[model samples]
Target: MMNALESSSTRPYLIRALYEWCTDNALTPYIAVLVDDTVQVPREYVQNGEIVLNISFDATSGLKLGNEFVEFKARFGGVPRDIMVPMDRVLAIYARENGQGMAFPMPVPAASDEQDDAAASPDESQTAEAPAGEPAARGGMQLVPTDEADAEEPTDPPPPPPRKRPALKRIK
Candidate 1:
């Protein structure tokens, strides 16, 4: 007999395995979800208390890549509905690679720091200019020629253009 904690730990894996099996058999596995109520305002969404088959892409910009939250369209009871879920929140991962395949459990979430470090110290390169003793640093700044020192100066503008072209004549 397994303890309650052990059973709980295995539950997600079992669900994933079933989903994969459905995919292998070319059967769509739907998930009945209790969506976060906060997201319902924009779309007038409804959970409808049934697992609906999700048909959407898994492209780079789509839901399957990883860590991306996505909104996809699905039809329930002949009415179109919008469903949003985070990839992390996915309970099952299934693919129809083989007819009647296998499902794998969703992985556990890892701990992460969500806070931004606005007060972190700046990098040395950003705060200070390198010393001139280094050869590389010496060539970094360009020298500008001053008008008072450099003597190759243009004194006058060229003559004005001709008002008209010479008339064409018959050649011998």
Candidate 2:
């Protein structure tokens, strides 16, 4: 049997499931993506190194949510643009209406990380880029818990409720 680290990534599958969930409930599904040279989208639409895409049936054409990528055609400012975002670049997929969905941890590899990897011995490279004791990585992607304590049961009390909502409120 394949070990957990040897298995494929679950990010793309989760994105597909969330997209279906949003559409089934009449909500707009939007994906927050981290822009990089590998991502293919209208550069003008990207803001602060990220871009949010609407992947609803009405918004995108030829949408293909594959294991490796999310390919589709979306319109930006009346111009139909082709979008191809790598699965790893997707940060979150949430319903625009209720803001309910999954938020994945963005894998921010250091600029010089790859160089160091290549220099390491073959066996050393097989281990996870994440710190020790965490889950091992599969290829270049690693799915780790948001908090180290998440791996075990919570012993502390829940966080206090927020004092107020976000500063920029939507009146509409």
Candidate 3:
């Protein structure tokens, strides 16, 4: 549990907390984002790979803030569009009225050469075989390499399994 907590990024938690704070005070919540190839937003609205968005309840619908991404539907120039932003791309979340909020460091991805060591060789036999979407296992799980072509590819994560409540029973 401790390891999980430490490994977990605090960006999502802080974003949710600040959003709630803004709404409680009747202030508009805004987010500043660094738009990368993975970000799904209106290209016209983005300038210099950065965009500021109004994320208040009135501005968005079906807002789902998750550990890996923030998903929502919002209107842009009278047209509704879906927006998906990776947690790492979020630079700051603040109240538009007072500009009071927190900013986080954007984690940089590792170099391609370092990440694609397993697939660098053209010879198929020389490369280790692993099923699609499954990470290579050495002694433990290893991170999978990502390609530039997959930058904007959306992932459909499986729903978490339901949990059963514990029950006490008498045993001989």
Candidate 4:
């Protein structure tokens, strides 16, 4: 028998489900990961200690969505790069088209790790885990649902002309 904390994590399963959902709906699956020494990704591509990966069938080769890690080979700057993301480092998995998917809680660092970093940065160690149903912040990034007005717009506008009316407006 295992205690609640000892049970296997559900993050991998959710990832697989969302990946399948994205594919079935013709959406591109993307995963946001918190980069650390343990994570293997292109250092140049990481920004603000985070990297968003496209996990779609078109983007990756030999992709393995495993219980412990998300392993894949992807091309960056036209060069092939092997990527490995530990399950704990995954921040969110969603579709690029509509941003429909799930956000996961950040992993709490082990007591030993906390002790090692305490001398270097005391403030980070003091942050508590999020409540049962809320997503936690990691590497100074927190994902919270926000309205369109609150979301930041891209600096470069699309080249196409703006539509006079919304495309397929939903009436409630």
Candidate 5:
């Protein structure tokens, strides 16, 4: 038997909940992920070690929000491809329209010394310290909050948007 922490992580459950929330509201769900060797995605679509995917029901087929990974098949540039993203690699899940979403702090992966030396690189150590949503010296840039508004935005905006939106409340 395994302990609760060892058996499951809260990340996947949150992902599933957010996904369901998006679908329930008829919102297009998008997920930003860090691309690595374990990820299976179209290399051409990836930008700067990251990829944002449209995981809406219309875009993905056989979408499985599993505990370990999110597996789905979607088309990229008209070619269907299977995309696999580890739950740990998911940085955020947001609605494409208004950008209401939750950003997850990147989990530090355990260091492994016994792995093949051929795959090891000097830069591997740098990533372990750089949490998601922050920039690293190695030049990997994560999304950081900025106060500057969009340049093209209306100087005098319309009335304020509505408040009191539906949100998931965890019991524990």
Candidate 6:
């Protein structure tokens, strides 16, 4: 029994979960990511490794992985560009961080169901797909600096490339 607001809030999380499920099942879920109201790009862009600015877009645009930092690419004033920021990057998302942030609970497979699926085919056991999507599960928090920090003085210039061996003249 969830209220309309609660249901609405959960949409993004559901979308994310579906995307994960699709990926686990070897399916590609098409996603349209919009940054800053003006620019939009496909989710493949993020998958391809590009930094992008954060901006609010239609909820139907796609699953928003909130509370996490993501780097993506977008256009600024009709020019191609790239940007990076935490999930908390967008001003709108920050405002909705409390309860409006999306969430999707992981689907639990029943033990009997699992057994049935396993009995159905031997190969299925060999290919138990990961439950989550990209950004694999991590055991512990690791601090990673996004920008340069604690600059160190250069100890020495980079070693130059090895010179080619001189050709030897044939003896007469």
Top-TM-score candidate index: 4
How does model 5 fare in lDDT? 0.79
Regions of candidate 6 where Cα sits further than 4 Å from its true position: 6-8, 33-64, 67-172
Estimate every model's Cα lDDT from 0 to 1: 0.40, 0.82, 0.80, 0.84, 0.79, 0.40
- Candidate 2 clashing pairs, residues 3+ apart or interchain: none
Backbone clashes (count) for model 2:
0
| Model 6 score (lDDT) | 0.40
Better of 2 and 6 by lDDT: 2
Instruction: Tell me, by lDDT, which candidate is best.
Output: 4
Q: Give model 2 RMSD, 1 decimal.
A: 10.5
**lDDT, candidate 3, 46-131, per-residue tens:** 86567888889999999998999999999999999999999999988888877788878755555564347536664642455555
Q: How many backbone clashes does candidate 1 have?
A: 14
Lowest summed-lDDT stretch of 10 residues in model 4? 163-172
> In every candidate, how many clashes are there?
14, 0, 0, 0, 0, 6
Query: Distance (Å) between predicted and true CA of 7, model 3?
Result: 2.2
What's the residue-level lDDT of 156 in candidate 1? 86
lDDT of 4 by residue, 1-172 (tens): 8998999998999999999999999999999898889999999988767788999999999999999999999999999999999999998898888877888876778867767887677766565565455446544455468998868887887799866832221111
Candidate 5 Cα outliers beyond 4 Å, as residue runs: 1-7, 113-172
> Which 10-residue span in candidate 1 carries the lowest summed lDDT?
109-118
lDDT tens string, model 1, 1-172? 9878665444345445565566556655444233443232124433331132343332112323223443555555557556565433443333333223223343332323111211243353234454454333322333446786566666886789979833211111
- Candidate 4 versus truth, CA RMSD in Å, comes to 13.4
Cα distance off (Å), candidate 2, residue 59: 0.6
Candidate 6 deviates by what RMSD? 21.8
